[model samples]
Target: MVGMTEINVREFRDYAAGLAQQAASLILTKRAEITATDDIRSHSQTKTSAVDPVTEVDTAAEAFIVDSIHRDRPDDGIIGEEGADIPSKSGVSWVIDPIDGTVNFMYGLGEYAVSIGAMVDGQYVAGVVINVVKQTLYSAAVGHGATVTYRDGTSTILRCRQETDPQLSLIATGFGYTQTRRSGQAKILQEVLPQVRDIRRMGSAALDMCRVAEGTVDAYYEHGVKIWDVAAGIVIAREAGAQVRVPEVWEKNSARGTLVWAASAELAPAFERLLSSVGANGEID
Candidate 1:
């Protein structure tokens, strides 16, 4: 039998929550700094494609989180969007997305977040996602349920809507960075739009999943999302009673794979069928 660490899920969750909030605060400060200095345009750099961007804040925030993890959990591994890779010796690895929705952040659209997830032996167990501009936080620990906390200290237990009909359920989705992938996603959306109550194209996948958890949207699905993009949101959504369909390989290039989320188990099959019908399962480009 494999040895399991004597870990406290709640404690781990608390730490992740603190880390996420700290990173988000750092990002918010940096954004303010940019605005104050009128230097927003100079801080961004494109990655993979011109549409995909990484801001200086992204790197700085990630560095702050990485430094914290190194200081607090020396034995745990880290995988971050800004290229942090540390080997795990304690069987726990932390996934970090210092800023999800960089485009939104760049444009001051207010949908970005700091997402952090913890995995033990490759299985996600705890997560924290903080919407920095909105001061909203969603968190979950395995078997401990999920909750959303606001800036005023008010908190609510997350619960997904139980809409049984696909036609009446509202779904959220996002497009990938590459033009070819965007074209394929657009085609899929054309078929899915009329069937659902409506669709929301929220730029951030992490926030989209959190919206599902909070019943703001009935479901969410996407393609080509990185591990850091959905890791934290996945745990929060699942803990809120949503069903998540992750690809077999978490690290696979989702440009050729898919990630799906639904608010209710009863509505998931219908949504899956709709996606299948539109050939949304096929690789983009």
Candidate 2:
């Protein structure tokens, strides 16, 4: 990767946001076509586990994004969930999740999103996530604060709740695809549930991170999510004033068997202590 002294993070953020918006349109168009093509479901497959579905739309979207990035910035690398990987020549790389919640998308849920994050030398510089069905967008740059836009074109600066008490804080989380892994996740949830206000099993990790950013949820913690699943969301949540510590986007499989959490600064300490108490602060599966 080529090293450069200065990088335009905001511009990169905008480009990623634009890509997410375009991909959202593509996903919506595919959804519309799915209604007419009943056999398409048969063509879909799973990854990592039986329940981790991957439709043609996901691959197509990733190809579209990879091609777009190649055309616009040939020297930049790309790492996509659909197995799009290219080496970086410009010290910049993109991490992308074409469809963050395939199960939710197939089930007609509104929690799925297209997530993109740009990094320089393995550090996040900018990120964007667009909720396809809801037409909501979240974006952030390293120095620029995060923001969320709604379907109505209205936008708001994102910020997690200040001084959100650990006991009263509502937490969001997700389960793994494999039965064995999910069983392990359940054990963590069992220990964490009674400590927070409640738990929400959102279908999308990207959107769940944005929920934490916008204060819709006080915290989010999960394990076994790939870099594409949380790269964009991590930047958004951190820029929105949420405390976060997770693996680098370029770290291969670093998130697997490791706990990742984001909470308000006020709640992070106690929440982390709680996680340690429950044996969630380290590798569990």
Candidate 3:
């Protein structure tokens, strides 16, 4: 990991955003082809759990991203959800999630994204997430504000809502793939569901965090999200005025990380307290 001082924020931000946009384009093209095919699941397979699906498009997207990064930034390490891991030689690394909501993409739910985050010495410096179906782009760089570009080509600065009242907070969350972890997640959700305005199970964590950034959701919390799932969106959320908190000790390989995001600084503590009250701040045990 390289120190933060060594990174060129704007340059890397542009690069990451471009990579994400290109990857999103690739994903959308593949999605179209898959939708036209009769056997959509023919090239799909289960991973880790029978419910955890991986499609050919996911692998192809990751390959394109990894190859692009290797050619453009050979010294930078790459870690991707589709099994691309290269050691860093330049103190920089890119985290990639080819398709954040594969299930949603497969079922034509229009809730998936391609997420890319650049980090220096394990600290995020730039990030980008593109909603493939919606054609929306969310991006951020450290010390710079977050912004969202719409399908119409107009862009707007992003900001989280200022609502501090927990009951009025429209929280977004997600479930795990395995039955055991999902059962534990259910127990936690049961305690917190009635206390908020409502709960939305958005199929994509990356997009959910982006929703927090854009004030579409007041807060978001989820357990067992891999780093690739939230790395890019978390930066956008934080830069957009949302306060985000993750586990003190992060282990990318462990499917037990907990992430919490609140719309504003004042609401973060209140949200954290609510999460603790419901025992949602810890691992799904």
TM-score of 1: 0.95
Per-residue alpha-carbon lDDT of candidate 3 for residues 71-100, written as tens digits (9 for 90 to 100): 998999999998998989998889999999
Clashes of 2: 0
What residue runs in model 2 are displaced by over 4 Å at the alpha carbon? 1-7, 248-255
Task: Return whichever of 2 and 3 wins on TM-score.
Answer: 3
List lDDT for all candidates, in order: 0.86, 0.87, 0.86
Query: Compared with the true structure, what per-residue lDDT tens digits does model 1 show for residues 1-285?
Result: 113333666777899989888888888888898999786758899987988899899999999999999999899999998899898998888999999999999999989999999888888888999999998999998888899999999999999988878899999999888888888888888998999999899799899999988999999988778888888888899999888887767663334546455566767788888888888776665
Each prediction's RMSD over C-alphas, in Å, is 1.8, 1.8, 1.6
In candidate 3, position 251 carries an lDDT of 71
